[model samples]
Target chain A: MSTPTETETPSETETEGGTRLSYETRDRLYHLALYGSAALFSAVILFPIYWMVQNAFTDSQTVITEFSWLPSPETVTLDNFSVLAAGAVPRYVINTIVVTAGTIVVVVGVSLVAGYGMARFRFRYKESFAQFLLLGYMFSPIVLGLPLYLIWSEIGLLNAQIGLVIALSSISMPFAVWLMWKYIQTIPESMEESAWIAGASRWRTFWDVVVPQTKPAIVACALFAFAIAWNDFTFAQILLPSQESTTFAPGIMRLIDQGGYTSWGDIMAVSLLMTVPPLLFAYFLQEYLLKGFEVRTR
Target chain B: MTVHIDNMTRVFDSPNADRIVAVDELSLTIEDGEFLTLVGPSGCGKTTTLRCVAGLDTPTAGTIRVDDRDVTELPPQQRDVALLFQDIALYPHMSVRKNMEYGLKIAGVPEDERREHVAEAAALLQIGDQLDKMPASLSGGQQQRVALGRSLVRDPSVFLFDEPMSDLDAKLKRELRPVVQRITDEIGCPVLYVTHDQEEAMTMSDRIAIMDDGELQQAGSPKEVYSEPINDFVGEFIGQPAMEFFDAHVESANGTAAVSMGDHTVSLPATADELEGYVDSPVRVGVRPQQIGIGDPAEGIEAEHVLDEPLGDETHSIFETEFGDVTVVTHADFDGDGDTEYGLVLDESATQLFDPDSGVRIH
Candidate 1:
């Protein structure tokens, strides 16, 4: 194949140079248009984040009086960050981290075992059980919020980080289980059988073989669980409303509602601060997240 | 270890259809160090039987014993059996060494001993140089060898293979068959292998058990099963191009019996006395492709030439006979044009007779 192409190159080049020049120009223009559209789409998606970061760097006075389309480095100040650093921001950050981490631990651990069970075992009403989990996922979190709040209060878990963690995890569980079950189905059951025949117990087979094979899905699930817990405002607002116990979402809301005037710089700083962890998580998990959908058994 | 399976059955119940009896009441024993193969068509329950033996699947009602110890209720790990899968399920994340050592590690074998066993098995498989590479990086044949090595390092009492070479190309499958045979022989364990390929079963097993529709049809040596199949299904299924069947009526006169098909009559051999009761009644006659010879055009049963398939060493001449299309293996040098008539002579001793109603071989 290559030999024919090599031999044909010289005569073809002499006869087709003009036509090839036009074709190459058209190809260049087509690629230019394609890249132009992609750049436009990316800018449209990232502009708001850019604006937020710019606002975070500006002082309160400049943000309120001299709002600009482009960032002006001369007016940039660390006052907003310093102000946030000195206040309840650190506590709220810690609370958010704890709730997110706790939600991930509970969701990933429970979903993995449940997902493996649903994927590998033949049990009564297994399909109905999977449908039920999906139904829970389809219901709006707000609908379950009031009932969950009441239950937490009755159980003396109100105003606690653990309560917040539980509430967020409940919301995340159904989707996590659904994702994990679908991912685990792609893995061949023979791998587990081989492990078992190799003298590994069921638990050992799960941790040693299944877990490593399904790591991409687990990481993707953990990131999603973390995102849900970190961004939840309604649950935190209802379940743990106290100043010290509240998460960043509700805490930031409280910061805005408590004053006579809106502090633009402080709000921007806090919002920017709150976005960092999820952004970092998504950045680091991007590779595995892509792989999670395309996972196949070797 | 000798493995005994008694009255084993497996049924799969689903909401959409009738409960499927995947494996009927099947019983057999594999003597110590014997290599037995379960050969059948797709849905024949051979794989299910192997799974039950490996304890990967539990039989509905039966006891499976290894060395006289009941392992019916034990999990696969406790059964002390090694099962190699058709898909070569080596851990993708692990290197060849790690995959082979995994079982020993689970058994709490010390690191030094695990390494030694892995090295020994790798050397035996000629995979010592590839031990550090991951499974995904290996070729299909190499991966299969690693899977075999993984099972071999454990030194289990019984070995079960589920069509382990089904995924390989023809050349690779041919090359690996003897390697597997040699390895199983060296291991000196009772082995139960399952495959739908009859040629593999014929060449590799000490005894071949044929199954159909979840029922065990026959269990015997390859020659016994091939030459003396208990039923028509086994006779038809055990050969390539399969055994050709002719609808014929048996007639006996003056103590001489013959089968008549269309205008041709082939005399039955003396061994067919068991079929004498079916005289004047319809019976199915089977003749293996290799047993049908092309003689002088005027001397034997007449058939119209359909096509000739030259397969290097021999040519299978397909002919349109009164009994339908029949394939006969002839010498490679034998040349016959299509649309011409030829004489097909059936070897009397090799002819098979089966009852038409039940498909049971008469003699």
Candidate 2:
């Protein structure tokens, strides 16, 4: 049976003004455009991810020799994942996790204190200082990497995970502070004053009142610092030349650049594994991230 | 404990403009269990004074003493005072119970004691069932109760409310005013409440302190301030519908003073020696709307009927006369029709005379 057309159905809810398009038809057209663009953009962005997943499940020989839209069920194997377990991939991942966690801790600590001060305190050149913070954020990591490398070498922190953590934190610190400062501004001063009048010292009030209200901003800052430290390659490669200190991003590059036949299957498998932490973070904390950027007054 | 504010002053230094004096050498005292309301127009420094008492804002020049102990140099947390903000300032992330428990916890009260105090406060505020609910989940009145509960649990030496009921609806304000008064009575502390609403001041305060231009105009019981305002500003400000002023010529005969506005004249007692200086000169006469009698043209000064506004139980009749618009409050049943002439009768006992230039009361 055929569905009814616009001409045949003749919508009773047609709007009175401007145009003859029925409300339902207009709504449907708007949603179609919206969801169509979303789906197309998602596909464009996700195609490489789809390919990586396909390569990750296939045997190394099959991934190097064959190109297929869909893998044959019989040829699909868990051997590529087994190759990862038998190699240094897990160690590199652990290193990446360590750097990301350290970056988060440092970034969150500095940003909370600095941001709260910026939001609440009054002092000379405070506005100028806040603007200067974003200036550091504007510089590319490549521009900072060499100077940071020189600094780390001079400080005897080179070829170490601690060096990478400090470097990553510096890169993300400005943006995290700016985010937190603006977010904290939305919280009313009365809340803090109320706490103070309730017999809480300034420090106690900051921890009890300001910190809890800043959960969304804290989560967003952590995710941002995580992404910087986890996906970072230029700083990691330049700072940590030793094999033992290398993280996932540079370690994956080393696996591909062995000067022989490249392991496409192994690269895709490790790359797929490398994407998991950030994916999981974004999946769970997307609500707070949205709230962090929301224009709210509370 | 009694709270004494001695010459409290606050000057705000602005970068781009002239320095502003927010509160100028204001002094007042609140005896224990007394609810004193600082009422004034906007920018009259009531909120600034309250903040100074709470130690949130330091007075540029003053001493604030609670129970004869000077607290002017103390930090807000060190000063034993509880302030309820106009926004109600409840911690949004905390549950009602935790909010009430916050101050107690900060004071290092035992957890069991904190729980007991919170329960007692919640019971007093009628919010026992709301202990587990977040502030956002509660109604406006309930949220106000939670805020009050938070303060109640602290049991501070002084309670400060900065227009706490201003955020509530009219009905809620009427409902909460008595509850707040009762709470303050139960706490038996010196409460400093700040508001610009004169009705709230009159209905809620044991003594209403009226302020203008960062200076105290008058401080008295509502009835005294209403009937015996010390100046034209206080006379005009303290009453609802406000006292109206008219320029009148004074005439003294047989040691008694008679003042005439338009064609109406009212005789005053000989005891008002201040009126002798203004003989045949213009004096400002301020009279409340309820005190001005309205009747037929034969009774007194003739005025053209302008409008009659019904205010629930009373009608405010506006009349255009030789001395500007005069409003008279009468029974709700009295409604003036268009184009009718009415006479305004002013009794000397009900009218206040002031110097036209200084606005200081002449009698």
Candidate 3:
């Protein structure tokens, strides 16, 4: 079906004195080029992941040699994964997992309620208070390093998993609260009113009526907060004083060392391992993440 | 189910404070199964009156009773009255059944009975097909029906409508007004409906109360309120294009009096014996547009057509005359010009006379 009422190139020319090509052919060619270019561009964007995996599978020498312009069979091997098992990569991976999981749970749980209250409740200087909370995100971690280190040391929290969890959650809280605030505001006021009129108290209304509607944004917010906390290098650098307690970024930094020879294969394997959890988290939360960003423009 | 208000006037602020007197010393009775409507212009006390009856507001001064029981001191739930606001406050997140079941659930009705009431209401509103659908999924008219259903499930002794159909479109208003009328009639539950639109009041009420300036101007059947307005305000507020009033004089001769208005004269022959002593009394006399007609051009009381407002069915001609601006609807155009001299005859028997200074009906 076509919107024939519109003036196409050839039709405008044939009917109203123009010098363009026939409109039907031009319209067909336009849509065809549109779809073809879209697919080509999306494939180009995904090509790096495919190259990374293919190179990961190759034997060490062959993989390096055949890391060419395209995918090849002879240069693939599992040596990269084997080399990383002998290093501290596995323990580093476990440390990253604990930190990311702990940060996500605490952040999402605390932030949803705080955000809901901030957005829905009217209080004295509530807006200013919210802006003040977000001010935590304004300072560079490098600048806060000395202060954070001293604070942690005074409390004997330095180089600890609990300290990492606290640090990550505090950093990610402002973003979570802001995202949830915007999303929860969209749920209709009538829902809560009805719940109230139905004899449910305000808390019951939040949990039963308002909370269910905000799941998509909450899921997306958790993933985003987790990704940010998991990939953070500065807090890890400042807090970890020992390799035994180091997370992925600091662990990897310690591994490379002040040596001439760098463990290229093991580093690649650890980098690949460090990227997996976020990729999986994002994959499961793909729908909400897409919707979360979609609503930004709309 | 009795409501009583004593000195129940609601002043939002203090005695000397700036405020709008929504219900100004308004008092009335809603006998068991009697449907009463508080009709008025905006800012009149109609809505306030309904809210007072619903126990939504405490009246500053007055008493309300349902079956002679004093309910003025009660809360909404204790008042046993269901209020339907003009905004149709339905729960958008709930299904039609859930919406209907909501109030019942709040009142602690058992699950089975709640389902029974919801089902019955759903059937009554013909929204059974939409029982599982959320309110956002329904059309505007359907939402109104669901709101009605929600109130219906409450099964209160009285129903108070606060301009309920005012938010609806013309067609839907036309469609739902009669349904509401029929339900209120069938239920025989004393209903106090409030609306600012006179037409909605006329079509829906067995009795219409015209209000202005925080007071009830007149309360009676539609015909009585229109034909026998108690004052100039009621006279001017009731009819389409309103009742025309102008300064006129009464003079006596041969024991009979004639009311003179410019070049026009109407007899008070019907009230000759009744109005024997009154002469040269200045009064404001009213005539309806429907009453005055295209009389014989040479014989009738004379008027000049100043302008003609062509409503689809009939053309109304406004005349700037010796008396005042008089308007009449004429089916046939007497002249093509915008302003032309024309003649009119007042139906003297139907014409009403009021004392101009006090605006009270005189004889």
Measured on C-alpha atoms, candidate 3 has an lDDT of: 0.74
* Two-chain DockQ for each candidate model: 0.69, 0.70, 0.14
- Candidate 3 lDDT over residue span A1-298, tens digit each: 2576764655557776565666676778898999999989988987766656655665656654444765466655677887566666777777888888889898888888987887788788888887988899789888877798999999999989889889889888888888788887876564564455445567867876777667777797688778877898889888877777778888888776838766555666667777787888888689666775554333
lDDT of 1 by residue, B84-143 (tens): 899999988788899999999999999999999999999989999999998888999999
Compared with the true structure, all predictions reach lDDT values of: 0.87, 0.87, 0.74
Instruction: Please give me the DockQ of candidate 1 compared with the native complex.
Output: 0.69
* TM-score (chain A only) for the predictions, listed in order: 0.84, 0.86, 0.78
lDDT of 2 by residue, B203-295 (tens): 988999999989999999999988888899989888878898988888764467887776777787645455667888888888888888887
Residue range with the least summed lDDT across 10 consecutive positions in model 3 chain B: B333-342
Span of 10 residues, lowest total lDDT, candidate 2 chain B: B268-277
Highest-scoring model, TM-score:
2
- For every candidate, the chain B TM-score is 0.96, 0.96, 0.89
**Clashing residue pairs for model 2:** none
What's each prediction's TM-score? 0.91, 0.93, 0.73
User: Compared with the true structure, what per-residue lDDT tens digits does model 1 show for residues A100-202?
Assistant: 8999999999899989999988899998988887677666777888898899999999998899888888788888998889888988889989999998989
* Deviating ranges (above 4 Å) for candidate 1: A1-44, A137-139, A291-298, B253-256, B271-275
